[model samples]
Target: MTKLQPYEKRPYRPGVGMLLVNDGDLVFVGRRIDQRAEAWQMPQGGIDEGEDARTAAMRELEEEIGTAKAEIVAESRDWIYYDLPPDIADKVWKGQYRGQKQKWFLLRFRGQDSDIRLDTKHQEFDAWRWVPLDQVPALIVPFKQVLYRKVVQEFAPLLARA
Candidate 1:
């Protein structure tokens, strides 16, 4: 029998993440510039105090990816958590957060390709592209792979219908 892994005792930052899809069911991902090395991830950001998860999801989608031209189609039933790899954990959130406890959302893009912009007032990604949902897990950092896989599994049906 496998032993259940215990949840880390560290605090997780409250954040919202987006799984934005186009008609072909491809998901939006971006190459993060703030990382010390190469990394690709979906749009995500911190949720402000008192903001509901859905509102934070929309706000994060636009703030990080440069567009709010999407509608929330589904939300994760529970908060999903990911811990930062030890090397950078103390540096990322000023030692206050170990990683993020995210509310993931599946958002359907309702605007043209031209409507997507990366050069927002506060840029998060250096480049962006649409990728098959299954490939997302492999593209992100190792620590977040499990979370990404769960996200793909959670939204696979909705992804197919788009």
Candidate 2:
């Protein structure tokens, strides 16, 4: 018997993101570099080789926000997915992998807010800010708003526990 890989038949694979929260408030929302005014999203990135979803989540959190995984206080158990907008999908990702299937995590900030730094090496985000949980949908890119809503709704219980 042999195991089959989904994307082995395709050109790309779906990635995940962690929507970290702290005391019911989401972490720093970012403005992407290419489309500064048009893009706003939770910290996220691609899953690496041999990396588990949780490991990718933790790595992305630190790489994007400069905060270590030890700083997170909570995370969601399930995942939320959203497809890419056809307009820029080919230009950016160039794939038939559908889109990102993110595992939204509700992290409680265990470290100081000052730990956030947008510029690492490559500069994934240009600017960021801590916003209220209710504001995430309106602040994210319009196409991604639907996923934001889903992620929030699915993780609503975690907020109540904060």
- Top-TM-score structure, candidate number: 1
Question: Residue 149 in model 2: shift from native, Å?
Answer: 0.5
**Reference-based TM-score of each model:** 0.91, 0.81
Candidate 2: clashing pairs of residues: 21-107, 73-108
How does each model score on lDDT?
0.87, 0.69
lDDT measured at residue 121 in model 2 versus the true structure, 0 to 100: 73
* Total clashing pairs for each candidate: 0, 2
Q: Write one digit per residue (lDDT tens) for candidate 1, span 82-139.
A: 9887557755666566789999999999988888888988898999999999999999
Q: Please write out the lDDT profile of model 2 over residues 36-97, one tens digit for every residue.
A: 47677887878888988778877888888887644443555565666666555544554455
Best by lDDT: 1
